[model samples]
Target: MGASERVVPEGARRRRRPTKGGTVLSEQLIVETTLRLIGEHGAAALTVRRLGAALGCDPSAVYRYFKDTDELLLAVADELIGRTLNSWRPTGDWRADLRALGLRMHADYMAHPQAAMLACARVTGRRHEIRSVDAILGVLRGAGFPDAEAVRIYHVFVDQTLSFAALDASTLALPVRARELEARAWRETYARMPAETHPHIAATSGVLVAEMDRSGYPAALEMVLAAAAGRLAHVRSGPPGA
Candidate 1:
């Protein structure tokens, strides 16, 4: 090794084992590095060969932990679930709790936009994923929704949040310059549309521009929560199966 070049300390560099190069390789390390690569270089950078190069090991070594890329991707998705659920600090109000948790999930996915693009639709069937489903259903049922209604509402709540998050993250995962340009589209394009050509847009353009900087997910989430709350009230007062 050259003076500036660091040596690859002996740690099964040529073998498929726990540690590699100078680092102790684990599921967490691989997942974290995969996310970092996706964040820094987009999802395309997550190939086994690329990861091996980054970790200073052979590409085939990746199989020691994950059987293949799909499993690794699921693990990455599960990690996102862990982070989102872990951060949630629920308020007593069902509406408020759902809103906060939904926003948290959205923000968490957006934070890793490249990964979100691939993993948002994945059902990990892991601990984090199972617990999250249970918790959401529990919250709704606890708030007076019967089992079937609670399950239906939970599906809507999660699907809406993840679907919108994936859409937003695609834009966010773009190159920084591209993201800036897209971010300004509402103001730079729609807000400037001539009033004579589009009266309704002109009338509300000011408010549109003001709120364009805001994400639509939060508002959409509130609508879902409010609708569920209303249904719960009805269900509570109505006779059984009425």
Candidate 2:
């Protein structure tokens, strides 16, 4: 063959093999890349085009894994929930286990603040998430809660934990520039409020601003556990008059 038309080896004529790192993407890779993008750019900037650009592929590549952005967000949520499950374990002390789960979840979301906000309410019914819900329910039931009560407590506990984490992440994901503006506006608003017109607000202003940095998730979770335990105790104690 001519120099430009070199003879091909028996195996060399085959189409180039896809590299393991090629643009042929998997759902996990898409979710991971999307999460990384969300972490750096926040949810609003995580369009199909942007994600595809980051992944070094065509925008249509994402569609091969997820039908739309909502599907992609659901996948991201499932991935976060799976991460939480991997880090959580029941330590025999139901209340303590619940508290640990809450704290760990908060920490994980804070680690990926923008992604956490984006995936907050998108539930995928993924196996790991279902397993987590079941595990929490089992703990409540083992703590002497009836099936209905266990389900109720589980719903409240999971919802409260996720909701607080999302809210915390949303605040943390705010740009420093936006935060400064918000801080200035808050100070101005607080300063203009008449003490006589809003006695409780005026009285609590200092405490509110001072304690804002303190983590409230632990306290809030403890209160929830206390309420659940109290309700369980009352149910088992027979009537007060008895």
Which residues of candidate 2, in runs, are more than 4 Å off?
1-24, 183-205, 239-242
Q: Show the lowest summed lDDT stretch of 10 residues, model 2.
A: 1-10
Q: Give the TM-score of candidate 2.
A: 0.80
| Stretches of model 1 off by over 4 angstroms after superposition | 1-21
TM-score of candidate 1 against the unseen true structure = 0.87
> lDDT per prediction?
0.82, 0.77
What tens-digit string does per-residue lDDT give for candidate 1 at 1-242? 11233323434323445444677666678789888888888776568888888777776666766777777888899999999999998776788889889988998998888999998899999889999998898888788788889899999999999899899988787788997887688888889888899988889988988887767998898889888988988987899984
Q: Cα lDDT for residue 81, model 2?
A: 83
lDDT of 1 at 90: 74
Best by lDDT: 1
Per-residue lDDT over 1-242 for candidate 2, one digit per residue giving the tens place of the 0 to 100 score: 11233333434433243323464456777789988988888788778888878777767655645667876788788889889889787888988888888888888888998888766666778776788888888888888787888899998898888888888887888888987776665566764567889887688777765556555787889999999989888768967433
